[model samples]
Target: MTQTAEAAAENLPARRESRAEKLLSWLIRGASPAASHLLLLPAAAWLLVFLLLPVACLLALSLATRGPYGTVVWSFTWANFGRALNPMYLPVLLRTAAYAGSATGLCLALGFPLAYYLSFYAGKRRETLLVMLMIPFWTSCLVAIYSWMIILGRHGLLNDLLGRLGLIQAPLPLLNNGFSVVLGLVYFYIPFMVLPLYGSLEKIPRAYLEAAYDLGASPAEAFLKVTLPLSLPGVFAGCLLTFVPCMGDFLTAEFLGGPRNFLIGNLIQNQFLMSQDWPFGAALTALLVLSLISGLYFYQRLEARQIEP
Candidate 1:
């Protein structure tokens, strides 16, 4: 009787699990295709309301004309876009691209080795190091930029330290230049590059490296032939993450690079705020959005090709 009671008690939990699983399966089977799609309504509505609607409005605004009094007129024209591509603004656009590209390159150079170290050699300190790396994000971006200003200003920390060390009699002119803008950009965006690279490198199995070793390949050869190619996806993601935001950034150039270091973002901001030329600003914004979208499309095609046999 005792044995039978124990057996029944053990079977009770299994019976309950089976009943629950059966209920789940029945619910799934009974769900209509329309009902399944209805589950996506909230997410679809969010994108439509927040993303698509704003972009459509921007496109419409870009096609509209600016009144002589600086009001937005409903008249359709391509003049705004043409004006955006004028030689006057072409140099600014090119400079913005150059800054973004420089920052992206520097980030890749720094982040790849750091990520590799974190993935393969950080050992017990990996989590701690990662947390430290992310610590800068805890504060506001403006705060970070202000800190950089303090460090880079003529009478700032770096200059004071150098002066005390007798490195120079005069303070270095570090602020308000293209170099400062790019430095700010690299400092801010390098973490974005490192995290993605670390994720990619960490996912690579040690077995692959071991296999490469067994094939009489040196460590450097193994890394070059096996690790680097597999990590290209991370490189692509990191570059995309770094470059796009760098191109659109205004604060770094505004605070560090000053007027001479103006970027596309600064131009758009001045157009909308200072000049009250919303149509032209919208056109510039639309062009930037289109360019980013085209890049994304190309990346997708490349990724698809890589995935195919």
Candidate 2:
């Protein structure tokens, strides 16, 4: 009787283990392929509703004709695209490109050193410094730009300071110019550049630098040969981030620039809001989007080629 009891007790644990395994298997099997795909439905719906739908509408509108009273007429037309490419708007496009390019270059020049320092020299204070860098983002961008306006304005704080220091007889004409617009773009986008660069620099191992030193390479040579090449990805990412948004931004030009500093963004805004020409505005927007996509595709191809063995 005792031997029988021992065998039953051993079989009881085996039965429990089998039951647990079956329960897990049943749970897994309950999530059918259809149900698994259903989990993606909400995200797919959101993209369709918010992103794809608007782009489709814009595309349709761009091909439609503008009515006599700014309403969109259903008649198909390519005049809007031609209007966007007209000589009148070409300068605005060029100016936008120049401003964005200058801002990107300045961001790269300024951000690289700051990122290098933060990644390599910050040590325990890295977190604190990064938080400080992010503090500007918490404030409203418009408010920050307005503050710059006050500072850069004639008879404002800068002028007052200069007067008190007896540096100049008159206040400098700092506001409502290309210089001010570029300043605002750089100020707003520098952090974007720095963050990417810091991410790239942080991933680089210190051992590589040590090895370079051991090979009797100078610091400059080591940096140019090893560090700079590895950090190109970050540089490209930062430039894209800064340039793309800067190209589309109108607020900086509106607030900090005068008539002469008008950009493509300003022209687009004027088309939709001031002129109420939705078709032309949509065409301009579509062109900008296509240009950006083409640039990104080329960049990706270049990156792929660089990565090939």
Candidate 3:
């Protein structure tokens, strides 16, 4: 009877512990919803304060009038926006688009083969090659651009070597043109193109390609029909990444390209710095942001259609 009582005493504590745990879990589930929400609120507030606040300020600055002292006045004017929307700005926008388009295409074309070879063929060296691609990004983009100018200029290695080989009678004109701008853009953005494409291609299960090949489809056919289509999202993402940055890049054009190659970013810079017109600069930024947002929205819809049944 004494042993039985001891067992009952042990069982009572065990039962009590189990009940306490269950009650605590229930309480946490019920009462902790607001506590969890509190965690998310800080990040939301940070974005509002840092990101959205500046955008709000820029918009306000765009709408406000500029005083004689270049101070923002509390007056609404459509003139800043109207100048941005004028037809003269159209060529600048189109030229920027053209340059950005060429660079994006080049990045995709060059990056695809490297990404493919590394991801699929490099085997043990995939990580190493990826590291190499990322290594250039560690250095400032301006430094790499300066290096390109030296490499391609008249007294540069390329021209010197070509002269020795008698391939050209004169030093080639590689700098200070749209071609150089495109080259710089592609060089800077190639890594961006590679990573997203590599991600998409990596997610493509090997069995799908094997199945396609086993079913009498050739290598090219399998890729065209299955692999490429599956990786469309990555391609679109890479294009957008290249396009957006290329559009906003003023430094590349100023350093590598000449008088005929000023883009919207350069124009925006001029308005802000040289002209000392904060309102116009802000207006241009707002318009560019809208264009980017609209582009992304359309791209999302296109992606949805492809993924959906």
Candidate 4:
């Protein structure tokens, strides 16, 4: 063979062998890069056995029929699902949604400024102020409900003050209705809304705000154009957390609002407890989960859109 041709022939096999070795290396990596991932197996098994299994059971109960005694009759039926879609249920669902939405909106309105102030202006006292906010987290939410009752009841503080002022012959209808329920929900959930917003707002680079100021933008303009928009993810996250819990919240509706305001949570609680309708209650629980999941899905979609160009 010619010297050049011999060199080419000799090198071609080496190059081909190198390519083959690389392909083998990639195949080996692709097949078992996480071969020691068996560490996750136990946790996965625990979740399946506990969390997922219970949800599966609840879902099955939703699909199954309720017996005369409200037991889960194994005879499969979609009647429960159909009943949930009825107009009567629709109104309750809508009312709950409206209440939750309003609470979320109010939470954002009230929490946003406080969170911004703490994050941007509190400075050396930020830790102390933030610690104060977390004090409520340590307390029982149920206790707060009772406290609200004491404050909003007929002989409560407002009534005493107003009666002294001769504003009315009787106390206003502040308790035992939708308004107080919303108020309690707002009070209970405001911290949830604040913490997330504060977290997001705190992370906002000082450089961005400085840039806006340096570019001759006013403080108001800097916040609106830079701070508010950047902090929206936290706002959205907090709203979602607050809204979902409020929708499914029974205690707030029951303790403060009493009979005039019965939420879906009350109904579910009744079906399972007093009514002896486990299957029906399970169905109701499933429906609540589904609704929450749907709402979360939409919220996440909106968040994604907010993120996109």
What is the lDDT of every predicted structure here? 0.91, 0.88, 0.87, 0.87
Per-candidate TM-score against the hidden true structure: 0.87, 0.88, 0.86, 0.85
Clashing pairs in 2: none
User: Candidate 2 on 1-309: residue-level lDDT in tens?
Assistant: 999999999999999999999866765676666655566678999999999999999999999988898888976889988988899887778888899999999999999999999988899999999999998967788999899988999978898899999998999999988899999999998988999999888888889989999999899999998888778778888888898999999988988887789788888898899998999999999988887898789878876776563
Tens digits of per-residue lDDT, candidate 4, 26-92, equal 6566666553345457888999999999999888887777677666687688888788769977677
Q: Write the per-residue lDDT of candidate 1 for residues 1-309, one digit (tens) a residue.
A: 999999999999999999999866765775666655566788999999999999899899999999897898987899998999999998888898899999999999999999999999999999999999898856688999999999999999999999999999999999999889999999999999999999989889999999999999999999999899888888888989998999899999999998788999999999899999999999999888887888788887886676563
Clashing pairs in 1: none
Candidates sorted on lDDT, descending: 1, 2, 4, 3
Compute the lDDT of residue 256 as modeled in candidate 4: 88
Tens-digit lDDT track of model 3 for 240-267: 8888998888988988887778888898
What is the TM-score ranking, best to worst? 2, 1, 3, 4
Model 3: worst 10 consecutive residues (lDDT sum): 27-36
lDDT, candidate 3, residue 285? 84
Clashes of each: 0, 0, 0, 0
Candidate 4 wrong stretches, greater than 4 Å: 1-38
Which structure is stronger by TM-score: 1 or 3? 1
